[model samples]
Target: MSRKPSTSHFLLLLIIIITVAVSAARTSAQSTSLCPSSSVNPEFCPINCFRPDPVCGADNVTYTCGCDDALCAGVRVVKLGPCDA
Candidate 1:
């Protein structure tokens, strides 16, 4: 006969599964929302259009811009090169 899982074992398994699912969902959500909508062309408004916030890193600095929507907030990170006048 097969042995059934104990209560503690079942609870642990449940926790692990939930954690994995949540982590996966979070990662996918981040990837989607981290980039601005392609419909918004940056060429039209170069200076103030794509406002990016700076994030410091060990080797290079990164910039992130969030969508200031009425319901939800989203962010996009872009690498800034040399500034042109």
Candidate 2:
């Protein structure tokens, strides 16, 4: 005669699968970090806005305003226009 699997055995297997899935998810989530070019001293950084003004930085990255280029990006302002221009 063939033996049937017990309910407790099935429950244990389901718990193990759930635990492994959650552990994998947390590991992946923690692997992502802030970009290196972002502001190191964010306490004095300017608030971002949607104004039409834009400025280019010495690093060639276009920022939304002068404060972003100088304070947030910690780079000198290269020009008063977008870097793509």
Candidate 3:
């Protein structure tokens, strides 16, 4: 004879599956790090300066900017979508 799962057993299994799925989704949605260009001038660096075309991954949301050298400045962040571009 075969036994069926009790309601509590089914609930527990569902909770476990949901927890694992949520964890996986969170991991996959993490943002990537960005580095500024190596030739940016600090004196002219705008507080909100960012590149028009940024290289981004799936979870790009925030950005950080800094000058690396003396001629080029850049903003780094995961690529935001068109709305944020």
- Backbone clashes for every candidate come to 0, 0, 5
Pairs of colliding residues, candidate 3: 39-71, 39-72, 40-72, 40-73, 56-79
Q: List the residue pairs that clash in candidate 1.
A: none
Write one digit per residue (lDDT tens) for candidate 2, span 1-85.
9999999999999999999999999998776432224453678656666665677777888777554535576676656767875
lDDT of 3 at 38: 46
lDDT of every model, 2 decimals: 0.46, 0.68, 0.48
TM-score of each: 0.39, 0.42, 0.42
Candidate 3 per-residue C-alpha lDDT over 1-85 given as tens digits, one digit per residue, 9 for 90 to 100:
9998899999999999999999998887663234443444467555454544433433433323322311232333434332254
Writing each residue's lDDT as its tens digit, candidate 1 over 1-85 gives 9998899998999999999999999998777543345454444433342555443222333323333221122233332331222
Question: In candidate 2, which residue pairs get closer than 3 Å at backbone N, Cα or C atoms, i.e. clash?
Answer: none
Span of ten consecutive residues with least summed lDDT in model 1 = 67-76
Model 3: what TM-score? 0.42
Error of 3 at 14 (Å): 0.3
- Candidate 1 Cα deviation (angstroms), residue 74: 12
C-alpha lDDT of residue 30 in model 3: 62
